[model samples]
Target: MPDFKRGRSFLRGAPAACLILFLAACSGGQPSAPETAAGPTAASTTAAGAPAVPSASGAAPPSSAVPGASSSTRPALSKEAQMETDRLLIRAAKANDPVQVRKLIAAGGDVNAKDDIQDSAFLYAGAEGFNEVLKLTIAAGADVKATNRYGGTALIPASEHGHVETVKILIAAGVPVNHVNNLGWTAMQEAILLNDGGPRQRETVRLLLEAGANPDIRDPQGRTALQNAERLGFTEIAALIRG
Candidate 1:
């Protein structure tokens, strides 16, 4: 994990449109002030299997259970009802209301249900830096590594937002640190490109590195983590990588 510094001109003009898209996809939609509301976002998806909470180690039953269906006679939630649930989950997530969320999960809300844009409940929680919501979703069986339409995983979004605790929770729970998206960006890459390389972001790089992210790992553009660091003028990060 290294940091590179680029001038304001480079920072403002660098053609990282695709990278921003990738980061946006991974980081849960767009930039917003941290929300204290408890609800899901427009990107949640229906969990596919039995909705069981994840274990302390992050393992959970498969996502195959149909929401609102009994084992013998389970029927899927109506589209309208499902939509409302999605909204509730997103709001609850933003609000960090784990209690209501638990109630929804117990009542057969689709933990994996995607909002209109295909974002999962877990992704929304991760993107918004809702630690409690994220843990509740994961414990309730949301996919920690699930990618949205742009192939962004929960781990990716959490990392880009510099949510160190969230990222750590995801990693310790088995999210792949080095997992790449369609744009060839990894969690480590996201941390470097953020330009806001504070201690938490630095810690993110350290985590990814210790998790075995290759400091020399190159993106499709032949850019390595060190290169990105230097490009961003993150000298300390560069030094860390060299060390």
Candidate 2:
């Protein structure tokens, strides 16, 4: 006959041993910890097929990827293109076309750029009594003391032409009044020698005198302005110089 009591005790111990083995197998022979849910990864996708996660810092995309962003970025112009634009600006200035001049300047034309004759837009405008273009060049930062091909400031030619308003503008802009040109003639001398001593010339001479032009500056012919005036019978100008 079988040992019933012994068999029953063995079956009871079997249940406890089986339970320990099952726990060890599930944990790889170590105690198991609870697992939390994982967060979404960069490559994770949504049901609608869109990106489920943003960038690491969660910032917006680059400007280049946005619409109308390219319009704000202007590439630098090449040297040849800038030179051509500056040439056109000089032409417009010489033609006394303020509209074209403004357009060219807004297109990155240089106001101080010199052409083959060493004449910049600023110099040409002032020398030709183009007050509108001259003011534009001035506001655009033209060098006030810049010289022309004859090494003369704009005031010299303006005075020679009896552009009284232009002379006043140049003087107020701080052009050197006693600046002598390559011909060794100051603005006052050019006004007296080059132009007929009329009402405009007299006014130009008077303006120069008031602006502190030196009457003692002799010409290349070694003649003072006053002596030249007396010889030329500019009695009023000579009288003004005497004062």
Candidate 3:
């Protein structure tokens, strides 16, 4: 077989099915960002760190998650309650129901709760191209940069799934486009690896390059974005960057 790794690479990041698995494996892996007081300022908390809140695009403003029965004096959650809450939040995200999602979060459903497979609401929303859900999660303080077990971040998932809007949201939220995962793959690398070169991918590349992602930046093996695009026959992308 020809060496596909160099040029037209296939996505090696976590698969859609495996997303949940990845999140579960690394649930609550990082310290959530310190909570901020209510305000119009665009700051939200998540496991990875703080990212700015997305501007309301006519979508309902995100309702704050109410501190649930688990107050500062409350004990830890029982297994069943935790599972139920997880199910509810995941369903809300999948259904694209921001109100229900906020309710779940207010109830103490982890904004970044991972399923059995380690998929969090943010990951699922990004992967499914649910822009609204992704925004709501971000506003509710979801971790924008949390990496999955496969070393996939929300940016990786959004790019892989061809969710341009989600990708933009992630970028606006300050996700590092050139950020590399355990596999030595950046978000741009993942886009090329997945053979995704639609307008979204092009925009993603443009965003990364403009944001200081050196197209000349090489991976562990010294492969550049141009090299990958050229090898994959992504002439448009190569041309865009070469310009």
Candidate 4:
């Protein structure tokens, strides 16, 4: 079997149904640059710390979850209520605020809410290394395989950052290691092309390779991970890929 499907597991306790957001999932490299805020982020939060939620009464957004109300009498918020909750979720994710993320989820926000640019709270959490926030979104059932505006999976950006841990988390959650983006590059290819080709990125490449990423996959200009690593003087990484 190809390495791409070798590890078919997820972190224990996270729902394996796995809703993916495109991302250690960051797009190119560290998002600390001016364009940093715009591309890639990923996460894998364990639900071990999930706050206890109530039953029917507390399980829904406050707008709809009126205490002591019968089913027919239950006061449901209009669509506006859900929209507001989703907006708050986006803000919390953008700010990397796990507490706010948890609260919003408890209040009935969608884990898969996407912003105007097609960035989702879940995607931002992953791309930004917001571990706790990412987990909360996942526990709330984030679409683990969600796509970004550029038609890339979350794993592409995550690998590019040399975020080995985040990449591991995402892969465990079932993000494909070899998925190609609209730019026609795989996660492995992006790791070399967009990074410093340092130890961090090397480890990321190692992880992806171990997870079954195809090193032979190329970018738009026909450069493979090995070629990118070699041309950029990442001799050690290039050698590793060659083997």
Misplaced by over 4 Å in model 3 are 1-80
If the candidates were sorted by their lDDT against the true structure, best first, what order would they fall in?
2, 4, 1, 3
- Native-referenced Cα lDDT, model 3: 0.72
Q: Which stretches of candidate 1 lie over 4 Å from their true place?
A: 1-69, 72-83
lDDT of 1 by residue, 157-204 (tens): 778888888888888778877788788888888888864878888888
Give candidate 4's TM-score.
Answer: 0.67
TM, every model: 0.64, 0.69, 0.63, 0.67
| lDDT top scorer | 2
Show how many residue pairs clash in every candidate, following the order shown.
Answer: 53, 0, 8, 25
Query: What is the RMSD, in Å, between candidate 1 and the native fold over all Cα?
Result: 34.2
Give the Cα lDDT of each candidate. Answer: 0.73, 0.87, 0.72, 0.75
Best-performing candidate as measured by TM-score: 2
Q: What tens digits encode model 3's per-residue C-alpha lDDT throughout 124-236?
A: 88777888778878877788777676777888767755667777788888876777778877777767668557777887777666766667767677898889888888888
Candidate 4 lDDT by residue in tens digits, 147-226: 88878877888877777777877887788788888989888888888889899888888888888889988788887888
Sliding window of 10 residues with minimal summed lDDT for model 1: 1-10
